[model samples]
Target: MKRSTLYKDELIVQIMGMTDKLQRRFQSEGVDEERSWMLQQTDNPAVISFLKRATMMMLHVIDAIVALEPVNGIRIASHLGIPRGSVSKITRKLVQEHVIQMEYLPDNKKKIMFRTTSLGKEVSKVHLALHRHVNMNVHALLNRYTPEQLAFLAQVQSDILNTSLVKEDLASIKDDPPPAAENPPEAMDMRQAAQEDPIRDLLDMLHQLDSANLSKAKDLLQVVFFAGHNG
Candidate 1:
């Protein structure tokens, strides 16, 4: 095999360092309790300027709809691992913005589907361009590695997972613990509640997850991980 630009000894040392770093990062509960600076700063345009105006989760829904169109709300909810009701609300906003359209099967009459409109396609193109720009920049760092070395690096990264306790860890948590709700005596809607008290809402959701689906749930709730990491 062609050697990597990173020498084998250096590669091994870095991998060991990576494992230790991962363990320390995951073991800290204080990390999860802290608010994320990025989430708090809604006006930052370092990423996608247009996309930054709305909730970050909306982009995931928009991108998925483009890729899996002629799909319905239920499938979108499954794809994103969000509640069906939440997907319904997001899709409604997309429809209002002319980003997507709802269609029904002529034969079935009741079967609903979602498809991206022309405007939605334009938005998707911009979204995809942002991802491509970032990927190319990141891949520049890997260009010096031979194809074989890149493959080995991918394998090593995949082999380092330690998710066995995810379910055990999830199971140990209490069910549907009430949010602090301390500040708001008046009844605020779900959207306001989410924006005002993100952490409690997250715990309420985690209380509903289980070992069987926690991984998929986490895959979709990556913003949670980002919040923890950024905190």
Candidate 2:
């Protein structure tokens, strides 16, 4: 195997091990109130799946509610590039959780409008904080890289995933309901690509990074790639 490719393989194993540790920590650490609450919700499994799948959608929905006016299911689906049917299902669950609330305009009683409740807004803020945590961490890493290294990292990533994007398995939605809820749309699309290509599914998630963090990610990746070469 090429040295860089071999290093990437080892890196994937290390990351998987780190993820295993995080999973164990999350399971055992009942002291953290926030994580504790989320853990408690895992009893149903549906709640956990819903939150994981809808987090990005919720973030955008909350932003729309705060920055613009109230939005409806279609608006949310359109904004997130998912199916309206998905928006409907997730909004119903969010309403059940008392996270989002539905209302109607005075003249149009039939028209349902969606808005984030106080609880929903708080959850969105929490998610935003998690997003910022990664963003800041990557930026910190970028401080150590040169521009060429950053560019190379970006190029390598693009080259790796260059062949095709994910193809959604919509059929699974009908056949297997619960498991489908855990995979986000991006995940559904890129899963086969990652598996068949022998690349990381994480590269698919890189699209979620904000522009600044994405730039940082390139630099950080470059550092990892080159450091492997040197070592």
Best by lDDT: 1
For candidate 2, write residues 132-196 as lDDT tens digits: 76578779998798554555456545644553335655435442323222334565556434446
**Which parts of model 1 have CA positions greater than 4 angstroms off?**
1-52, 80-83, 145-156, 165-231
lDDT of 1 at 174: 43
Question: How accurate locally is residue 10 in candidate 1, as Cα lDDT from 0 to 100?
Answer: 85
Score candidate 2 by lDDT: 0.65
Query: Across residues 71-133, which tens digit of lDDT does each residue of candidate 1 receive?
Result: 998999999899999998988887877778999998988988999887667666665665675
Quality of model 1 by C-alpha lDDT: 0.66
lDDT of 2 at 27: 59
